[model samples]
Target chain A: MTMGFEAGQDAFARAVTDPEAALPPGVTSRRGEADAMRFAVYRNNVTVGLIRALEMRFPVARRLVGEAFFRTLARDYMRHELPASPLLFEYGDSLPAFIEGHEVSESLPYLADVTRVEAAWTRAYHARDAHPLTIAELAAIRPEDLGATRLVAHPSAALVRSAHPAGSIWAAHQSETVTPPRAWQPETVLVARPDMEVTVRILPERDAPFAQALLAGEALDAAAAKALAADATFDFGSALVGLVSLGAFSARTDDEDLPK
Target chain B: MTRFDERETGLPRRSGLGLKPEHYQSINDGEPDVGFFEVHAENYMGAGGPPHRWLETIAAKYPLSLHGVALSIGAAGPLDKAHLARLRTLVERYRPASFSEHLAWSTHDTGFLNDLLPLPYTDETLQRVCDHVDETQQALGCRMLLENPSTYVLFEESTIDEIDFLTAISDRTGCGLLLDVNNVMVSAVNHRLDPYAYLDRFPVERVGEVHLAGYDEAQDGAGDRLLIDAHATEVKDDVFALYEHLLRRAGPLPTLVEWDNDVPAFDVLHAEARRVDGALAAEAARRNARAA
Candidate 1:
């Protein structure tokens, strides 16, 4: 039976993403028969196109797991979810979480974290452009008012804290030969596009709380307190300078009405 | 019909190439003399980045053609408002010389399928497509060119001919057509029809631009020839011959050489485009000689 356009599309889309499903109704070949091979072309295009998009966004993950395994993981992920939007770059936002629950996580414990870093890097690369806060601007605040001042995080700034050294693993894969990291330790990676270039840096362990709080919109004194509570040796003086140098904060606008 | 005279047309009657990111530096440094450069609209929908920076530089030097792949103009539902807003933003930012989209649908109720899937060419779909073209033209506040699709399977329920369907859309909406010679070749072979006959029935007067690309060959379930519209290699010899045939009839419309997958160096693409330019030049000379 012939279906309506909407029904036809519903059937076609269902079959395109599911290999086991039959071809949609009303589809035919010139010879007047259902041609599965001909229909397979659309199936291949959608699956391969989406998988390739993921591969392009997460090259390091693909390299780490090998192309065959990465495709397997991507295919598994596709079974549960498809892109809700046409923006291909933003399609794989949930891939890290998907990988965390997959059985592959048992074999590659750090894979999900590495994917998180890769995902954040892409977000930073495409984030809105803004002028980064300068050290001079920070110094302009009165000494007494500094503790109460709220520094705005750059739109592109993202913090990915991992129990594994995902940042070092990601950096090590940049070259042809992948060498083992010097030490296996936790890392908190900072991703920000201060200017045109996207910068990815591993934050000092103790400063993670401070950067995290500031990024979450905590005031200067409150963020510093969080860092001190995390570690007694937390050096607030250098961490503030380091984050400003890294362009983690946006230029402050006096128009914002701060609450008392 | 909305006839775009020589002055009204945006693209020059020469050969162009699809702009790839790998060749951005080469294009910037060499500043090659070509007709224009075409880009996919969805690729630059991001808020800000190097994509915009490079596009800004390239658009300044060349005539930009914005081709949208994800608009889903043939969908059964209303147009995506957010996607239309983004397209409008892109048009405003680039002020491209030409804008075009496919006649196929990729978005369904579930989500975007990311591939140009086919639809039945019945009177129902024809009215739907005309409505879409009208909506898109109004949204962007500019005329759009709709291109034909290469299909693997046909719909038994389709009552209208592909040519008639496209002609009706153009006539009803006053939109232009983009005749992709490769798509004609591919669709003809898959449907067991003569490519020349398809071109003979095409509304060439309304054509604003032409697209040329390569197709991969395979056999269907019946062991008949099946051609996939894979833009991974140079334009096939048969497709180029068809293009030359088109130019002879259409009189040197703006042509674009598209190589999306397994892209080669800038010089290779430039050379392919030069090959097209050679054909366009010969056609123009023939027209001049006839005039004399």
Candidate 2:
């Protein structure tokens, strides 16, 4: 009987993941060998191509673990988790979680967080294009309506909170000199692609909640309140300046229709 | 801007190279006399950035062919609407002269496998492929070329020959064929079929483009001459001979030298393109001689 589409694909998928698995029925090499090594080409292509994609998405993770170990980690992840989309950039959404649970990566406790920063950077790189809120746009807003106004974050803006100083760890890998922080400290990474270039910055502890709140679609007052709760000495003016400078906020003409 | 019409701006019957970012500066600086450049559509699907910037600059100077790798047109599952929508947006933005996808499916019910998985050549498959091609043509608002795949294994239940199956799709959906000569060589060698005869029987009249790439040659467990469609090395002598045979028959079709992995410097790809151009020139001279 002819192999159904789903049945054939299922067998192929199984065979690709597990090299020892018997070749699906009716598969033979050009020379008519029942168990052809020719099938390994597909297996290699499927696994290697994915591992390469994962490497591209998580370069810092790959660099930290080195090539051989990262390949092992990537292969392990691919065995169970196939990409839900054809977009390779969007693959490995759950890689940090996978790395966290992977035994090989256990020694590098901070590897997961470093991978999280990398993933966020990738997301920011591919996020939708939007014009960032300008300082002039913020200034034009009436003082009375400032508290009530809901600030929009750029689509490319992303925030990552990690127990280890993952932001600094990821940045150090980019340069020739690697400088670990003096101490292991929690870090909040702000990933934004302003002007179509992905830029990562370590956010202050107090500012993390403020940016997170805005990204969560909170109103200006509520976000500020959260920031104040996080740190008693929170400076709203400087934080607002930093956010605008990094192209975090999105400009809205909501106040345009308001009373003069 | 007026939409690009394929009939008016079809790719020239000359040699082109698969555009890589590494060669961008050289290509822009030299403005090499290559016929055109082709890129994987998925690579440029990201938001506006260097990729688009480079593509825009190169496209302005030369003809472009947007070759898609993840359309999954032959999948048994429903077409990925999101991918299709993204493709449409890209096509609209770029206005590529020719767009093409492979006959093999890379996606299934679970998700995309990222490899061009093989399919059986049966009446059911033929019909399904035709339907998908028709849908894709409608979605892109243009006729796309379906590329032949290089297979490592064959299904026992395959009822039709690969050529006939591909011909049937072209006939049914009015799509053209992207005859990857290396693929024909690889698949033929792997299956122990005559590559020349396969090329002779191929429906070249339906061809819209031609792809030439190198393959890795090794023996399988049974010591059979196995060819891997690895676009890593230079075009092999056998593959080049087949390309010559194809050019003699088809006469200077739009050919692309695809070297994806282990990509060499611009000089290498440029030299390959020049060689193909030399072949095309030779074919043209032969045609002129015959006319004389």
Candidate 3:
């Protein structure tokens, strides 16, 4: 008996993703015979198209591991987790976590963190558009009320805290001639698309806590206290200015009135 | 409003090129003399970005065709309502001259498979496709052109002919057809059918637009010629001949040159579009000669 349309599609989809699976029932060629080679076209399209998407999304990861190893990793990752959405750009959200658990982590401990940075970069690129708060707007706020101000993070602002020098690693791979980082240390990278351009900046380790707190909607005084507690020498004024210049915060719309 | 008329494509009868990011700067600066520009709807689904910015600029200058690659109109289940809503939003935003999708399915129970997969032609599948088309047209408040698929494999249970199946869907749903000539060559050669005969049988009156692309050749399991719709290289001579033949019958239609994979520089793509324009002009001259 021939399989119904639904069952046949179910089987065809299964075989398309899984190279080892048998050809779906009722699938044939002009010769009226089961043709694995012809069916392999669909299989190859799904796998290769997805692998290319991953390569485009994470060029740094692909470059670090080489094409062959990256293809192997992507194939294994795809087999377990196919994209559930049509938005290919948003497909590999869980890849960083997946890489963390994979055996590659033992060899390259920073691979997962680098993938996280790349993933966050993609997220920031596609995040909703908003007018980034300008430094001029910050200067307008009264000094006494500034500490109570809860500046909103830009829609595209994202901070990826890594135990490895993932930011330096990603930056090195951007150019043709890559220079290895002089010293390997933990880094916190900020990914944001304030206006048109997506910028990746490595923040000072001492000020990461404050940036994280501010991005989390904490009041300015509280965020400053968090940074000061982490490092006694942390400068609140400079860090706030650096983040504002990086377009980390959105313009104040809802909270226009100062807290009296 | 009543069902959309097939003649109301809102696109000029000339050749266009698929828009690519690499060519955006050149397109913005030079503003080449192409008929229109087409983009994959999913690429612009992002809320706000350079893609949207460039598209907004280009759409203001030229006609836009919103082509969708992942609607999975042939899927057995109901259409994805969320995706349909997204399409509606895109339509409202761009107000493109024409919109199209494939007759193939890409989504299934598992997830969206990126490639356009073939389906069996049967009464059940036909009814499902018709329903999907109706829903899509109603949701977007505009007619859609369903392009035929390039298949490497066929189903033994297929009861209806491909051309007839397409005609039936268009007739039932009041949707128009997008006759992809390259797909005809690919499918005909793969299935041991005649390309010219397929064109002859196609309902050209219902065709709102046309597509021209290149295909990569390979061999099937039985060593038979298999053609993959790679859309990577230049349009094959035989495919161009088939397109010219289509032009003789359909007259000048809103044609698009699609090079999705391995996209070349703007000059190369523009050169291909110029070649298409040459054929279209020749066809127009012939039509005038006949009228005169």
Off by over 4 Å in 1: A253-260, B1-8
DockQ of each: 0.82, 0.56, 0.82
In order, what lDDT does every prediction score? 0.91, 0.86, 0.92
The digit string of per-residue lDDT tens for model 2 on A109-212 reads 99988988888887887776777888998988889988877777787888889889998889889977788777689999889987768899998878988888
In the predicted model 2, the residue pairs found to clash are none
| Candidate 1 residue pairs in backbone clash | none
lDDT (10s digit) by residue, model 2, range B7-117: 523899889899998999899999999999999999887776567878999999999999999988877767888888889998999898899999998887766789998
Each prediction's fraction of true contacts recovered? 0.78, 0.62, 0.81
For residues A38-94, could you state the per-residue lDDT of candidate 3 as single tens digits? Answer: 999999999999999999999999999999999999999998798987999988889
Instruction: Give me the runs in candidate 3 sitting further than 4 Å from their true place.
Output: A253-260
| Candidate 2 lDDT score at position A63 | 83
- Model 2 chain B worst lDDT window (10 residues): B1-10
lDDT, residue B68, model 2: 95
Q: Write the residue-wise lDDT of candidate 3 on B1-292 in tens digits.
A: 2576556798889999999999999999999999999999999888887888899999999999999999999998789999999999999999999999999999887988999999999999999999899999999999999999999998989999999999999888889999999999999999999999999999999888889999999998788899999999999999999999999988999999999999999999999999999999999999999999
**Candidate 2 vs candidate 3, lDDT winner:** 3
Q: Assess the local accuracy of residue A189 in candidate 3 as a C-alpha lDDT between 0 and 100.
A: 96
Per-residue accuracy of model 1 over B1-292 as CA lDDT, tens digit each: 2322323459999999999989999999999989999999999999998889999999999999999999999998888999999999999999999999999999887888899999999988899999888889888888889999999999999999999999999888888899999999999999999999899889999898899999999999999999999999999999999888888888999999999999999999999999999999999999999999
On a 0 to 100 scale, what is the lDDT of residue B289 in model 3? Answer: 97
- What docking grade applies to model 1? high
